[model samples]
Target chain A: MTNAIETTNLTRRYGKTTALANLNLSVAQGSIYGFIGPNGAGKTTTLRLLAGLLEPSSGEIRLLNQKLSGSGTEAQRLVGYMPDFFGVYDDLRVWEYLDFFARCYGLDHARRRTTVEQLLDLVDLTPRRNDFVQNLSRGMQQRLCLAHALVHDPPILLLDEPASGLDPRARVELRELLRTLREMGKTIVLSSHILSELAEICTEIGIIDCGQMIVSGSVDAVRQQLQGGSHLRIRILGAVEPAVEALQNTPAASRLPAIAEVRVDSSDERVLHVELANATEETQAALLTHLVTSGILVSEYHAQTENLENLFLRLTEVMS
Target chain B: MKNVQFISLQPNPIIIKELRIRMRGIRPYAILTIFLIALVAAGYGMYHLMLRQALFGGSMLSFQVGQGLFSGLALCEICLIVFLAPAMTSGAISSEREQLTYEMLLATPLRPASILWGKLVAALSYIFLLIFAAVPVFSVVLMFGGIAPWDLLKVFLLLLITAITCGTIGLFCSSLLRRTSQATVISYSAILVLIGSTMMAGSLWSYFSGPIWQPVPPELLYLNPFSALISIVTVTPATSTDFFFGGDVFGLPLLSQFAAGVVHYGPNGPVVLPIYRATIVFYLILTVALYWISTHLVLPRRRWIPRWSDVTFAVLLAVLIGGTWLTHDWWRVLPPPSI
Candidate 1:
């Protein structure tokens, strides 16, 4: 797949402090890429750089295979940026707000009129078209901001902390809206400190901390790469001590070569949480067969996947 | 193709937006009403005072009454320009920063020059409206027949130029400073220094020149709008046409001693350039330079960094060269009339 946005050694500095340091980023067309990081972790800086709002101290940015110039005016047409913190103009109606931006982009009058209506409708804010921008609720304002970004209909959208200050329902609505945009083939890159917020919607995730990207890939790929291997949960009827002892024995260890470590669940003694070392489905089946032949009553056997929150915490902890 | 480009640039969006916001509310109308009322009251009072003087002196209404009333109204209008012009635009860019809307505007493809131009035009348009609204009061000066329509036009032109220069100064400060209040304070302070220092310098130069009747060089008063106005209204056949600082109405004892013309010896005779013309030229150049600097300051990432002082130095150099070129006849001497 072609990359919608690409950066090589992108860096930004403010006086003696480095906000972003030698970062490489890539987002494929039509994919939702989530940038996960803590506060002051250069998430906003990276977005600003991509949005062409900040000049990079070193390195180059390419959007759709064209290198961005220093002024970023040409690239500005291809990227729609929604800043994390923005203010709406007072005394400006919602449609007028969109129209103003449209005019800024030098859109013709007829196009501006239709574009404003389409954007308001797309953000589901058509009902409040004439309401003053400041009078809208926070969530509605966010959507309006998003709508403003879309006025030019850029193919790539850079949203910084788009879900912050949003209620659950608003967040869900935002997600749906993003999904709709994605279906229309926009490469969406959004940032957040919360991993769960992006985990469900992001096709790909990059965890950045301390001005560096720790790891980036498809969601499952990052999980697998970070956790090293899958985990198995085994529940045997009655005496779980036998299963634990049997799994720990040298003979069983040799037979079940995939088993790395076996521990009984602290709360439920009959359950065993087994860590596997690079175990495939065939190896899991063999291990199950060997356990059953050893006279252990097995009631439930399944793999327990690690959640993204635990992975994020563990990854950041190790980095720090 | 050129026509298309020119057509696209008309009617900047910021001007439209600012005018809508400023005009939609009742505050501008209220301020305009109050401003007009004050001018009328001042005019009425000056007219009555002039009428009583004529009555007491056993004379009919004459040119002196009209001239006095015109000067009073013109001075009042100049004061309004000095105070209101800067206040209108000092908050133009800084308020955007305060409202957090500056970044969004910067992110667009609109050139920085367009933003600056839009802001200046919007601020000065209202000021121009205020100046033109008092035209009827100014027309009352025609009844007594001392000030001509041509003189009235000149006065309005000076007011317009003064407003533009003051507005540009406020905008420059607004772009340089981060907060609106700071911008406003600095803008007013700058105007105070411009007006105050010029008057003081002119008076001091006349004092130390060794003779009471010697003309203080016109360069000192070229940037003072008040002096320019004085020079314009007080012109007569007896006094040199462009002489300023000849009037002693403010009780400055030294002003009465100064000659009525800024005279420079030339091969032929004394040369005089109208102080109002010099003032207009100097201010127009200044407005352009300040507009340039403010545009650079408002940009998110300036392509080139030229210090404000550097621009100021360049402008001063241009003014000096232009001033010398405009008065080049002073450089041609005839060896003391072949003594």
Candidate 2:
């Protein structure tokens, strides 16, 4: 897929302090890409650069096939950016704030009203549309910020820790809202330190550490790339005679390491503990063959996988 | 064609929106109160000055007295500009930055230039509103004595120029300083250097003159914006036309022209003094350049241009010594020039 957002060697500096350095980024057109990093990891900087808010000291950024940064604002109009920490004009009610922002995006009065109403409803803020933004709870304020960002109906959204600091229920509500948005085909780039939160919602993840992208891709792909990693956990029943036979005969499975350990830990319950090293597509087939051929009444077979969170820590820990 | 088409589309009006937001806050009322206090003090001074003049002896002092006596109104307006400018603009952009709205606003399609223009227009609007309130106070002068309706126009226009120029200074400081107090201090210091220090320098320059009271060529008055404005507006109401649009070196009114008439005894065909023309053009151009730079300061660029706040502080020390030398009464071998 052509990237909706792309940056190459992008860097920004405030005098001697480097906000972002040698940054490379690409977000697929329709992917809900989670940008995970610790605080001060330049996630916000990267988002701002893509939105054309800050000019790169050196390097380039492109959004929707057009160059971003200085002297052009087309990219800005196309990207909705909600800052991590921001203050709304307290005097304006929820609907008024949305309407004001919609007007800022150059929306007409008639269209602004409809867009405001729709965005408020999407963020579950329709009821509080007439209430002052300041009076809203922190989570409601965040929902309002998200609603404000959608005023222009831009194709892409850059949300900086939208769920951070929100109550658990509010966070769940936000996650569900983002899920609905993704289903509706809005590309979103969300940044958060809460790995599990992103794990729940993001289709893909980019792990940034100390101003550079260590790795990024689908959750499974990233886990697969970890040298010593297990992507799937399987539970088997009835002695696994058919599976063991299928695994032994499978050509691809034959190349992988043998079951490293199998213990009669649950003999009373008629279960076995097996560790399959170098788990991959090839190994999985051979292992499955052994089970099917055995016909040993295979009862439970499921996978509890290690996801992007482990991959991120592995890459960042390796760098350190 | 593209440019024209761009213009035809509606403006985002982001600045105006922000300004409306700002106005709803306490700053507007606070600024208005300060502005009104200055005007009241000035009106009181003007009434007393007029009363003193009539009581002391009418026609004894000359038109110069008439002009100098009216200086209280100009002073009042300047004080208003000085006090309110720092309060209004000093906290403008920096407060937005602190509030974290700066980056959000920057993220929008509103260019820095548009933001600057929006801010300046908003600040000027408030200042104009303050000036608008003082209109009746000056108008009351007409009932008592020789103050013309044209003089009132000149006074208000002068106030407008002072407020606008000072507004630019305040805006520049706002962009550079992160703290409101720093912005205000820097703005006031800039005004002192730009206006007060020049006057001191002129006074000291008198020590080196060929003759002390020689007609100092009316052009020098432009150094003080108040003086230049008065020079143009004080011209006889009949000749106010000659000075308004793109004429002469200075922003002086008809009175300064009459003062110019005291010297230069030749056939009159409006011999535009190059020095006066250049000076007025320079200041006006400077004001425009300031407006332009302030626009860029508001841009959402990651890289910021070098700020001159530190350099300005250093230069001010030099100006202080230079001004002290000029204002020294003992250094003058001849007496000061009469009004």
Candidate number achieving the greatest lDDT relative to the actual structure = 1
Candidate 1, B64-147: lDDT as tens digits: 557666777888899999999899999999998998888788777777778888989999999898999999988997998767
**What DockQ does predicted model 1 obtain?**
0.36
10 residues in a row with least lDDT, candidate 2 chain B: B243-252
Of the true interface contacts, each candidate retains a share of 0.41, 0.49
Residue B94's lDDT in candidate 1: 92
What lDDT is reached at residue A143 by model 1?
97
Give per-residue CA lDDT, model 1, range A154-188, as digits (tens). Answer: 88999989999999999999999999999988999
lDDT of 2 by residue, A1-320 (tens): 77888888999887998878887887888778998887777899888777777678899888877787465477656788898896787877788788767666667667777888888889988899888889999999988888877777777889988888988999999999888877877789999988888878888888887788877888656656664634333445655554445444445525454665554445444444555666666766656556656564556554346655666677777878
Docking class of 1: acceptable
Question: What's the TM-score of every candidate structure?
Answer: 0.86, 0.74
